[model samples]
Target: MGLIAEHNCSMLLMDHVPKLLVSSIPDSQVVKNINCGRTKTAQIIKMLKIEAENELVQQLTKRKREREREREREREREREREREREKRERERETTKEEPEPAVTKKKNYEVDLAILKIIDEDSAGVSGLDMPEIFIDFNNSSSNKLLLLDEITEFSVLVVSVENDLEENILTETKVSST
Candidate 1:
């Protein structure tokens, strides 16, 4: 108030207030300390933001890798199962050569059940800021806890989208066009 009254210039009040205060303060050390503190605060906030982003990226990559590894392990199990079945059939054929011929039958492949990944989104508004809610595979049941979201963090989704297979010759063969 004193600085503003003395200066008699209230134009761009916010921009002038800091300068006026700095000018009024006799000690340069005080001004330097204030500027240094502001700079440090800004740097800390920036570093925190960067760290948060890096952590998110790392988590996403880890989830993707785990899913890939699990899929690969499942595929390998199926392959091993098929190989064992083939080996048993070969052994049976060799031993039953002297026996009477049996009726031909189709062999059934082993079927495995897959678990569906679900994300609990209590909020209707999933989109926050410019970035969309990141899709994550949460195996644990989150029924007991409430969905928490911050300004930097949004809700999780399953990332389901509509897709159609378009053949290469379809455009030329069908001649799809809007009138």
Candidate 2:
């Protein structure tokens, strides 16, 4: 429909317009100057439309920048979470590699009980009893059996079989020098 004929354009005041227009157009005749005749009102409406479009463009630019910043923050958070997960996995692998020192005195009759205790502890891990096998080659002529406790520095991880009094080596490595 056309502009409302009943709505008096003259009734509308200049004070309602933005303060920027007040400096350019006199308050008494600002509305009348823009809407001189029926043809001029159309021009005034077009100017207002251009100003609204500019405002919308600025608002859209601001929204786009905010969205970009939010996406960057989310990406940073995801990267940190991945790093934390990797660190945890490394720590778990290290713990598995280095066997906790067992200070049990050598016993003959209680060997089965000791083996059972070790197996029970192993069951708590994710791999459970899945470990490597190792055998003591007593007959190996190259094996140095007379090395002192301090000189014989080696760390080995083994899994004890619950069914039998036997241990399977998971890993073997030379320990760090005590000196």
Candidate 3:
């Protein structure tokens, strides 16, 4: 019998080898099949097993990479949330601080008296001829004796009235301290 050198060989595991010498080529006539020569069939089987293992390893690696990426994204989102919460807390704390009020006051005093009596009451032992400008300081807390140099001014006016007018224009000049 002549061996067909161009034929492909493969192995088929069996419980029993055929006792009779059948045709050398398989019924399928494929390059690799279950009924090929022993040596070539063993090599094909090894190659198939290695390929299956390689495919499984590649699938597992892909799944791991996807899971790691998702975990990284989750960590980044958590950090951002923490930062936002801190910013909000800082803003609320700043808003809770009380604002300062302006520190100033104003008072108005009205005086209608003779200028010489005011000078006599305010200035003592200072002759009227030597008086230029006199200022008075009072130590008493009496309301009747309380005196203020500000809120005082002199104005001269002539009366003029319109028919059925119930309003009067009164003008006074005063030195007032204000903020």
Candidate 4:
């Protein structure tokens, strides 16, 4: 195509460009650049002098090599970033191994808390899985009048049960089940 364009031969403008260049002929940027705007039997652009043409072609090849090198550099940068991320992850794992695990305070599960003045027999502290705060439900379960305090069980049925209490280690007895 370059030779044809150089000799100012007629060229047919193809929109789809089914056939770019003949295998016998070297690819030509000038012919490739032509599009639907260029018509068949049109006058081709004049080529540069031999020395100038060779110089321009060499410059174009150099620019192509530079672009390829730039792409390779960008790929290498991305690879380095990936390695840095992996290194950081490894450092985090190593620190985790060296450092002690965070102490997890055992959560007490209390269904209700009976702050009684006097018990039926001995004044023994009856603890259950339902510990104070979240699970401690204050209820008047004692048969004795000596017990005095706010009964939280009065606010409807608080649904005191062994629900979610995985461990039977703590004695969690409801008002109905309490002896």
Candidate 5:
């Protein structure tokens, strides 16, 4: 009789405890009086399983969003790094494009010396004695004058004409005068 009583108590606990735990009902009598079938139990289990799956899906979505944000941050860092590298490359190229200071200084020195030499020669010419004048006419042609300075006191002059008619006229005049 004691064993049968214990068995009945265990059956009562098994039937009522799960409903009480799952529904959080304060009244044990309501749980015992409720007629819960296999379909109802299965539906409750399915609802709990669906809730668990929803929570898992929400966690996975949060993790996926976090990963996407991290990827964007990494891409931004890479873009910044590339910009800095390009800036450095541009600076290097600009430095390479400029002339070196030493070479520029040498060129300026050579130009200054040439200017000074021309000034000195002009001053010497001004201080020299009187020079002779020679005339050659080229009304319809081109001509060039060259001065040969052999010494400080002696010089020679040469004139070149570019037209055949002028040369013939000069030669004929010279020949008539000489004959």
Candidate 6:
């Protein structure tokens, strides 16, 4: 017979083998041989099916383990990125909060005073005396004092002194107006 016909005959035999064994007389020696062959074929098919199921289960378990590991790696990467971002934000806030320069404190005060001086009627007007604007600077813990001399129809003289409570010297300018 040709190869195709032989294969078909074998397939037909395999299909009928179980039925033939079931219908044969139990005491016959030929039936015992056929039953043994059928039991071996059924055992082989069951073994193959079990092996296929085991392989499939192993593949699925391996894939699940790989997927879990990938997810863990992704989570670690995200946590690292979040930490880096928080560190950068902290650095930015620190840079933005710069220290300010120290400033010295000081107190200021002002006083105004008027003075009148008596002149002798026998004294003539003084000549060749020029009155000019005066500026003085000094340092003291006491208050300032001013003295003015007014002469009748003659030139006037003014004296000013300032006291400073600070560590630095104080500057004072005095201007005298005549009426």
The TM-score leader among the candidates is 2
Q: Determine the C-alpha RMSD for candidate 2 after optimal superposition of all C-alphas.
A: 14.4
Query: What is the C-alpha local distance difference test score of candidate 1?
Result: 0.41
For model 4, how does the per-residue alpha-carbon lDDT over 1-179 read when each residue is reduced to its tens digit?
A: 43333322223422122232222234454443333344432333223233345666887999999999999999999999999999999999999889687754322222323332212212135555232232322334544223233333222224333323565424354441112
**Model 2 alpha-carbon miss at residue 80, Å:** 0.8
* Model 2: CA > 4 A from native: 1-8, 11-32, 102-179
RMSD of each: 37.1, 14.4, 19.4, 15.7, 19.2, 23.2
Cα lDDT tens digits, model 3, 1-179, are: 21122333311422122212123223443332345556655654455456546656887999999999999999999999999999999998888775658643323332222121133233346555333222222213234353444433333221222222255433333222222
Backbone Cα, N, C clashes tallied per candidate: 0, 0, 1, 8, 0, 0
| 21-112 per-residue lDDT for model 5 (tens digits) | 33432233222232245565455445545654665688799999999999999999999999999999999999999887762111111112
lDDT tens readout by residue for model 6, 109-168: 222232223323323265653443243332241543653423223232334344434655
Error of 6 at 120 (Å): 59
In order, the Cα lDDT scores of the candidates are 0.41, 0.45, 0.43, 0.42, 0.42, 0.46
**Model 3 lDDT, full chain set:** 0.43
Clashing pairs in 4: 109-129, 109-130, 109-131, 110-130, 110-131, 110-135, 111-130, 112-137
TM-score of each: 0.31, 0.42, 0.38, 0.34, 0.40, 0.37
Please provide, for model 1 over 1-179, each residue's C-alpha lDDT reduced to its tens digit, 9 standing for 90 to 100: 22222222223332434443334333422111222244544553354346546656887999999999999999999999999999999999999786778744322212112112223233224565222222222225444233432211222223222122362211111111111
**Mind sharing the TM-score for model 6?**
0.37
Judge candidate 1 at residue 111 and give its lDDT: 14
Which prediction has the highest lDDT against the true structure? 6
lDDT of 2 by residue, 1-179 (tens): 11222335633423243444334332333233344365665566556456656766887999999999999999999999999999999999999999889854321111222221222222336554542222222233355243212122224332332222356333333222211
Quick one: ranking by TM-score, best first? 2, 5, 3, 6, 4, 1
